[model samples]
Target: MMRALRALVRKDLTLFFEDRRAVVLSFAAPIAIGAFFGFLFSGGGGGNAKIPVRVADLDGSSVSRAIVAALEKDKALEVKSATSADEARELVRRGKATAAVILPKSFGEEAVNAFFRQTDKPDLLLLRDPSHTAEAGMLRGILTQHVMEVVSKEAFSGPAGLRSARQALRQVSEDKAMAPSDRKDLTVLLQSVVNLQEHSTSEKTEALGPQGGIGVPYDTKEEEVTAHAGETYNGYAHSFGGMALQFILMASIEFGMGILIERRTGIWKRLLAAPLHRSTLLLARGISGALISLAIFLVCMGFGMAVFGVRVQGSWPGFLLLAVAYALMASAFGLLLAALGRTPEATRGLAVFAVLILVMLGGAWVPAFIFPAWLQKATLLLPTRWAMDALDGVTWRGLGLASALPAVAILLGFTFVFALIAAWKFPSEEG
Candidate 1:
């Protein structure tokens, strides 16, 4: 068995070296993809840099002034003011602002009304580009968190203040609804006051400008909240490596198709007529395909590390064990593909499509966490997703062997199942 395996392995290596296409597919493609995507993911689209936030407060009223003050306080953000919502939107469109916050007139009144009525709505309009999801979400998170606290407080306490105001409306119009413009204006006024109140109490606090609109109540304390350094690593290395592993496995068709051609040309029958056992033949093919998968996997990882500075910080032994397990699963999957695809055309078409679909759903195309809750749960069944998660745990999170054990176990199970199916389906020469 050892001699047969060595001979088969040597033959595979020789044939693979002689074929430039095979060499390119197995080695060159991985390195190229790693470098290209490494740059792409690390470029402007990634969350590596801070984006500016523009503020436009039209109300100029005391409330708008306070909210503007709060805007100037966030350190993660750089604030600029625009004259109107249209101006703010244009700045966002021109990439001058990652996002813009507009405080319409009457913002304070709505806040005052909502506060008195115990309602929690504050009307601050956000203008942002749809393409910048991460930046938009981040800005939303920071602004919303601070704004809501101030707005909600008004919800609880502002009604009492409104009641105490000495000036009463000359007439209350009953039949007509409040204009949208008037409602927006009211909300802005209340929020500005709320913004002013919150920042005034903090360590870096400043008093609100008395009815005289000074620039928004600015605070220096918020600067401390945003001062972390270094490039952001969004855990893309493991994901890229996992994808490389999954696709390299598809190259098993190089061997799988080779098997069929050999059979048609009487190579298998001739080998069967000799002393070789079926187990030896099958094991040789599996090992050869697995070695190819491993080589491609390693090349991608090395390129990623050398070029992109990504490293596997976890246990080396644990990573190797997982790699080996994943390779076996990949090899088995290839054999399964060969067994199912009786013709080269069918194998190429069906295998490519199937692998693509699997990769897409497995979170190779997008992180599994981004999927809907149900889709995330569904991804558990895919071998690629598990491989991605395991690699992420090892390389990105530096997880220990104990934590990666479940992924290893599941991958090995998949290998066993695929191998068994291949063994059952793979035809012996005479039979």
Candidate 2:
């Protein structure tokens, strides 16, 4: 039985490889598509692309200049100075800049006073392009953090410290038993506090905040936790996973066509005349198709990793399990297609349309997260979705073997159902 199955499998492989165009289309096309998408979505090595921003600093004060310097230091933004608010707005309107930050003429003075004396706050105007709202939001966050840091520094060093010092002097003045000279000294301290409160120089950093106090303006530290530690995200990983699943389904057409041709050409009758049982012959064909699909999938992924830097950060064993299950499902689907369709021509057209729909709904072209909530739930019913999910999980998601079990089970369940249907409905040579 094993020898007969091996011979049959070898025959199928020989016939498949004889068609050079089919081989190239099945493997090379998906690799090319994955590379294109990988480059497009990866943003060329996972770095944030800089958004152009215009800064309109009308105050020209040291504080305003510090803010401008901070904005320029951010790698995510390309900061350009604008002479006027009108010029900044024009840049945003012309699509040359994503957003414009405008500081009013009294911004520096107000900002300083607001921190030290609890005075009226300054408003910084942001002119953002409506189309680039996400970029504008990011810029807003950066600006907010910078403002908080500057204010926190001023609060401790400037008015906050002077206010505390003045209260201490006022308490000392409340002592009626103090000597005249001591009282005079207390008054001097009180008056100095008032002068510092009213006419404090922004340059007096040492005299700011409470004595011996270290103020941390804000928390700028970042902490990131990934499923796979030490593994940088590779955009090509997901792209290759998605594209491999899509092309594997598309390749099912060839399997269906091959079965149809075999039945039409009386090859099925010749195979039945051999010592092999009818079920055994069908099983051999299914195994051959599954092997071919698995080979194509691996080749595509291998090419992606070699040339495009795609990495499998998760369990390789789990990834192999998913590949095998999906290949079996693909084989079963092809057999079912052949069993259901009356003619090869009709089956080809229907298989193409079906595969394309499955690919789209399976999140082959886009991440499943982009799907509407209802659609995302609905896609759970699709075998392709599970296949894509399992591949993505084990690849870029860095999921373990345990995490991939459910997807493997679902794909195997689909394979069983498809195989049962094909076995029941497959055309007999006599018919």
Candidate 3:
């Protein structure tokens, strides 16, 4: 019995190895996907990998320049320059830059004023992408820290510091936000500093802005902008689309299996021998497959909306257009599978493995934004990627009908390619 079991195991292994496509895809899927997931989960961005940001220095003063330089020196950030705040905003919108920091005109003067008075904050604007909110939070801290460090040193020792301190002393008593005791304390400190400067011009002291290290010297007004109709981003709205895609494609694979079974069982020979043209038969099958896949997607979406708070935040018509286009693409993909496959028995493992890899590359398992720029760009050629992007844009992104059209067009283009190849390869004559 042991010898027989060993022989059986060897036979199964040999059979599995005989199908080269199955072996390659079966093993390749895990390795390729695992590497990406490992990199993402391990906090594995190296020195070269840094968050990209745009800096707009409208002030162009020595102080503003120093702040920009400090941000450039930070290892965690990848900085680029924009000539204007409008240009910086365009960068964030285009996805060329992840975030933007705008230093308005006279920001340098206000920053110096802020160093002495806790209430006086320099005007700063931060335009951020909603998708990169977590990164934005970290970036906000980095920006605040660098601005304070650079501006504080400037406000402490320079001739301007004495002038600003004296100016602040006059305003302290009139400031309504300050408590009476706090106002008096600030008044005496400023008075002493002005007196010391006048009496001992040669004496100098190194100071890091406020004595107790006050909060950020700049007041930032942050705005989240993207091509969305919704005010906020909903993660599940896009995630459910990913899940629905997987389910729809799985159904398509089954459709291919059905075609293979019919071909193997002499159904094709009988059907072709009749007056019916092969193209008509193929078209009917695709239509049925498309309808089935669409049903599956709708059911999945229904559940997602009921349970997960997923939404059609964008135009309803646009969302439906994406879904229909994806369904047609899936049907064409099914036809391609049937044409490539020798038999249902031979194709099942390979087809399933291929689907998984496609889904992974499509960013169903992991978000594509986490991918390096090049990989994200490369994945755009894929129909799955196009579908996923449309899903994101129309759902969480709140994009309009116009935005969805391009992805729909791409999906139809892919469908045409898949159908053309399937028609060329599909066997009409019985073996």
Q: Tens digit of lDDT per residue, candidate 2, span 1-431? A: 99999999999999777666556555655675567446535554344457788999998876678788889998878899999977876566444576788887867656655553243567787876543446667887888767655554444444544554465466667878879897897687556656765566555535544332222222222111123434454667767887888888878778988888988898877888888877897798899989988998999999998999777667788889999999999999998988887667667766776787688778787554334445556788998888776676677656678767888999999999999999999866644
* RMSD in Å for model 2: 17.1
Candidate 3, poorest ten consecutive residues by summed lDDT: 206-215
Give the alpha carbon lDDT tens digit for every residue of 296-384 in model 1.
78878878888877677666676787788888888888777766656554465556555765676675675332344445557789887
Task: State each candidate's clash count.
Answer: 22, 4, 0
Off-target runs (Cα >4 Å) in candidate 2 are 1-225
- The segments of candidate 3 whose C-alpha lies over 4 angstroms from its true place after superposition are 1-25, 36-97, 102-107, 122-125, 157-162, 165-214, 219-230
Error of 3 at 223 (Å): 4.2
- The ten-residue window of minimal lDDT in model 1 covers 219-228
Q: Is 2 or 3 the stronger prediction by lDDT? A: 3
- Give one digit per residue, the lDDT tens place, for model 3 in 130-221: 76777798899998788877766665555666688788888886789989999988898888766755544465555335343345667898
Instruction: TM-score each candidate.
Output: 0.53, 0.52, 0.76
Worst 10 residues of 2 by lDDT: 217-226
Candidate 3's displacement at residue 391, Å, is 2.1
Candidate 3 — which pairs collide? none
Q: Best TM-score goes to which candidate?
A: 3
Model 2: pairs clashing at backbone N, Cα or C within 3 Å: 156-209, 157-208, 157-209, 158-209
Using alpha carbons, what is the TM-score of model 3?
0.76
